[model samples]
Target: MTEREHSTVVGQLPRTDVSSPLTPAMLTRLVWALWMASLGLLAVGATWTGPGVAVDGLTVLMWVVVTFFSGIVHSYSRRYMAGSDHLGRFFYRLFAFTLVVMTLVAADHVALFALAWLGMGLVMADLIGIVRGWPQARAAGALARRYFVASGALLGAVLALLAWATGETTISGIGAQADALSIPVWAVAVGGLILVAMAQSALLPFHAWLLSSMTAPTPASALMHAGFVNAGGILLLRFAPLVTLDAMAMQILVVVGAISALGGKLLKTVQTDIKRQLGCSTVGQMGFMIMQAGLGFFGAAITHLILHGFFKAYQFLSVGDEIERTQPTTDHESSSMGVAGAVTTGLTALAGGAVFVALTDKGTHFGSGLVLVALVVLTTLHAVRSVVGAASVPAAVRFVAVPLVAVTAIAGYGLAYRAVDVALADLPVVTAPADLTIVHGLVLAAFLAAYLAIERGVYERSEWLYVTLLNATQPDPETLLTSQEEYNEY
Candidate 1:
């Protein structure tokens, strides 16, 4: 290697040395200690069996998820960023972000929660800026910081409204204070919280940060892609009842979320780089989660958040194994099905979903059952297509396997629903208003229209639209994709 190139990579990293105090082992020891403290608190919350500091099912689940995610990413980063000059400092920043996430979820007082929320943004600014030697990384960090400010502002508005309406400074009390508030105050608070949720989660216009985040190490990306990025959905779930009470908030959440989901997913299809693709996918998934939350399907949204977080984290950490995971041969031949497999797949999915819904319907309204059914069918179809796509099974075996897979899937879903149901029972069952039902259809139509436009080259018809989207991701992903050796693989 050339001297200049070696120095370039080293210069791009933070100035730190491997030492006893700065070792990855030492860094993570303290990190794990704090995380274990949270687990102890979790046990206490469970035993209290009464009003406590963010001790409900949702908080407990999130606390555990984030702590474990931190540990996994910490261990992964030990090797992933081992060669970097800033290895020690990187852990410091990453640990700070993870710690802030834990505190935010566990915060009981309104002020403390808000403070923790602000602290997350501050720490993330440092975490994302770890590669300051790269101008592209700096730009991405600045862009993310601006959005973080916007989110903090919105959160501030929400807290002000909450305090004004109920004279309560604790999160638990504010949730309970919902019944005492005037309609106007409640509406304003809910709206603010929705926007805060969107901004924090990088929905659409605020999403360039995720792409820019690729400039950081893969381990930090895993920490983010897995658990940190879901903060918005988590926040919405934290305030699910408030979200459902305001008709305007619900409408805005569904409409904007649908747009983000469609746009983000479409963008993912066009991206060549893995990190950019994953970032776009996260945006779409977060939007879908927001939509689920808006529809008052908090259980499904929480499930989606937890499941997607871990899956994405695995993807980030396993970047070196991508060829094996999606190689389309051997075990990865899932997406290579022919026409017959496709047809059978559709039929099996439909039948399986119908049976699942029929057998498990607890008289759920607002189409919650439909949501669960659609997701189950889609998940089942994908699995069936993958295995059947392998084309190794006899026709008779394939036919019989369909029923077995369907039954197993429904049973698995039943377990998931029960888990989410129990965890979120502390939060009320929120449903969308009847008047907002039409908005749902319009949102879906918009999503379809977007798909068709992108698929049909409608954007190409307009020079500016094409150019804008082509260069849509900010901090110029081109620099990160090319012209930079340090993060190219990432």
Candidate 2:
């Protein structure tokens, strides 16, 4: 068969017919209803506070985000996977994973939370390898299963340690007694939680699973990237009290986050596949979220995750369009700005920074807040430059559009930050800004140097550096397909 014919056959359902009452289309509507209900609950300020189950601002926010993304993925999958095999099983597992994540966020009891966390990983692994005949899909699922199991084990150990030390079975109870815990106990617990976060978020060494998971269907990838990967930041935010106990632990988070962010970004530049590039991008974005938590702004971390979830979900769902758009472009187009364009970009960035500070009240204080503000400003600068340097646009139009877009984008971010900050105000250690240290300066310097190197194409010139990054970004060989013949079920 021709390549096109083979792909068509691979996408076809098995010859043996299977029936189910609950179709993917039905599930899509149900998920959308649930999403709407979550929004209504948030609107009415409904909450439940208890020992075994609790629903507060964080829970409500996550509920809305989770259900919304789940709804979108389900809706997309209905058409995307129409002729594929085991359509019913796929939706079932997807819905189960969504519920598991929702339960995890609302769980107050240590056992319940742990079980939900484990369930999430298991269901996601199942979804990753839903096509039973595909060797690549099975391998990807197995690889991811290992990482998820390791993450769950670490989280379980930490939760057990905290319960043993505090004599509390509930998360709130443990937090209330966090201050009384000894240094050694605090150190071990914080260390374990960080490891759990790292694995779940696919940071650095743990990122291979995500890169190899492209064998899964697009909807599964969308849900995994949009909702599942954000679990690390959610984990850290939920345990903010315990994490903030050790200043040294917080500093360690900063260092680790910086490394992961820079490493992920560098790896993304070398990836030729769209899905792997997105996986690397998630690692970098998660690093920034963790860094926000380390800076004692858990609220900001929450904001970052929510926004990232929406953005990534859309990106994944629109992958077809992305492929079509990029297929015709073989050469890289360099963007440049004249003196007027440069001036416009600089002024727009400054205006964006001012708006951000005015709305969020950041950068006024010393410490990591200043660093966060600078990063935001730099992001604005990059965005404005992209707009102003567009070769097809008229200079007058580019200059006119730069400030408007920058201010609007920054203003939206500021609003989101404020909303999240307000929602999490009642939570302990949610916005505790840490004092600046020499260690932070060193990390910042290293990040800046790496950023400059990438922007200047230093890695492209250095064969060793290019090779290192290429190897670092590659998926596991076991999860790769050598040919269409190897992809038994596509």
Candidate 3:
């Protein structure tokens, strides 16, 4: 059947238009109220002098971010998911997930943290399969649950090991005694935490769960991308002391993160579905966040995740706009840039780099800071490439837009980086940059090669590579909907 016909059939499914006493409007208000409370807490946290485990800047920052995203998702869902079945249940799971995330970030006790982490995974699984009658949703939820369970189990083992080794039940206590632990115990604990972060953030091999989770509603998807996936970065930041104990472990993170970043971007290019494209994008973005943590800049990771949350939330919430396409791009629209455009792009990138270095105080000398600056410059160039290369746009307009966009982006990043750095200052090992090694060099080489190949469309020319990526990105067969009738039966 044609796309329009399928949409018609899907749209014809029964919807409960009759509003209950606890309506979407009511739920929206409730979410806003929670947001307000979180805001107040953030304010109090700024001046909080009392002794507490979870009342630090990191906890309050996360609380505000979670509630803000939750509020946006709820407000969007009120209209986007109107008349949908299980609306109340959706709201319930969403709120629970938000609360669990907040608890996970704020928990100072190892046991409480583990429980909150587990609870988060469970709530997310429920939301993924909110439509019980839909087999695809159920299968998707099951797939995600397996991954999440494994992540939780790894976390449990790590926490138990830390508590046992340090004889400390509290997270801060474990961190205090982490350095005193034996090599084997520390190695195993760190390894487990790495795996937990990998699974939670949907990095590399652990990314299938996220790619297959399209069965979730748009709001859930937003929350998953905006808040849930970010938990990995938060986890890393919270355990920064333990993670930064070993140089090899940090290098491992860099390697894994680089691979996932390149692989996810490649996969995104081949995805036909918009949601799946965004999923692949999240994998790539999360890879960057992990890389930042690996570089001993947990503050940067936090900043990245926060900004990414806002970005992905907007992307998912406004995804309906993607369906309403106008005219397709012609060959002329995809034309290459001229000499003038190239010069402008180069200057814009340079200006972005200077702004980044001046404000963030990175990349002044050699090491990971230099690498970060290079990445930022490349990112700036990429951001403006489309605009500069657009044959339809006037040259003058392209030139003007490139610098304006670059300055804004770089300045914003710099400001956020400073704020996060200060907020996380009380935490140990939050910005311990690892010395560059041969392994890092090799990883950087591979990353650049992948980036070049992607930019040049090498994968498009190589049928083997294209098919490999396409097959690799496919959701599990169990989660696949064979026909509209499968879900339409409800």
Candidate 1 TM-score, true structure as reference: 0.81
Candidate 3 per-residue C-alpha lDDT over 112-156 given as tens digits, one digit per residue, 9 for 90 to 100: 889999999999999998888898899999999998888888899
Poorest lDDT segment (10 consecutive residues) of candidate 3:
1-10
- 471: Cα error in model 2, Å: 0.5
Error of 2 at 138 (Å): 0.6
- Local accuracy of candidate 2 as per-residue lDDT tens digits, 186-219: 9999899999998898887788988888888989
Question: What are the lDDT figures for the candidates, one per model?
Answer: 0.70, 0.85, 0.84
For residue 15, model 2's alpha carbon misses the true position, in angstroms, by: 9.9
Point to the candidate with the largest lDDT: 2
How do all models score by TM-score? 0.81, 0.93, 0.93
Show the lowest summed lDDT stretch of 10 residues, model 1: 2-11
Expressed as tens digits, the lDDT of each residue in 1-490 for candidate 1 is 2122222122243234554356677767766776687677655556223333555666777777887888888876776676675676788887778768877877777777788888898778667777767676676677677778777877977887797788887776777777788888887788788778877877887777677777667787778778777888878877765666666676787777777887787677567678778888888888888877766667767777888888899988877544322223454334345787777777888777766666546324555345545556655775576566666677666667765776676666566656766666665553333343667667656755775576466876887765666576544553354555665533
Which pairs clash inside model 2? none
Which is superior by lDDT, 1 or 3?
Answer: 3
